[model samples]
Target: MSTPTTAPATDAASAETTAQAHGVELTEVAATKVRTLLEQEGRDDLRLRIAVQPGGCSGLIYQLYFDERELDGDAVRDFTGVEVVVDKMSAPYLDGATIDFADTIEKQGFTIDNPNAGSSCACGDSFS
Candidate 1:
């Protein structure tokens, strides 16, 4: 017999309310890589922005990219050596979220673990 798995809390509105509502942590390795990138760019004004966009099989997708601009209504937080900025609109969808980096071949990249998502699609794209 197989045991059933229960989902995370169905509501994460508070955590998703603002950029500072919850904290996101970065691994030492990931932070170091970000630091190196900034040093190489010779620009400290850039930030690592994480956003949730509509698409993917799960009806939403995670977007990780570098941004130098802060638009109206943005949640910004400093994670050790890197500044993580998530737009206001994307906050609720990504509340209680953590951005992590893995060096292993199986998961060698930046990944977002969002508590707000009820379920992620089969391909790890989009979420309910």
Candidate 2:
């Protein structure tokens, strides 16, 4: 049998505290959604990675996905059973950003509210 030594999953308050410390907030709804997705995948080694890449009409785009690799200078925060990771490069651009999931009749998807964005494209996919 393997040795058990990992820390327990953090609660919502701790998650929020971590979010404040990490500079990116992942809402409870989004965390729940991520947990569900991870449960479906049946792998506990994955972390939700968020990065800002140069592309799109506004010169920059956001990338969010499940990643099992841990790169250098990565800032990670755990919400319950889900972990959200942001690379050091993207941290400045995504500072104070709030990630949320909306399941409404009007719109259904993950949305990012970034305070660092000066202006965004018409399609709302990119920002300068």
lDDT of each candidate versus the true structure: 0.76, 0.88
RMSD list, candidates in order: 14.4, 7.5
Best by TM-score: 2
lDDT of each residue in 96-126, candidate 1, tens digit only: 7777777786767777777889999876757
Q: State, as a TM-score between 0 and 1, how close model 2 is to the true structure.
A: 0.82
Q: How many Å off is the CA of 127 in candidate 1?
A: 1.9
Q: lDDT tens string, model 2, 47-127? A: 999899999999999999999997767888777777889988999999899999999998888999999999999888999
Stretches of candidate 2 exceeding 4 Å from the true structure: 1-21
Clashing pairs in 1: 60-126
Task: Report the Cα lDDT for residue 50, model 2.
Answer: 89
TM-score versus the correct structure, for each prediction:
0.75, 0.82
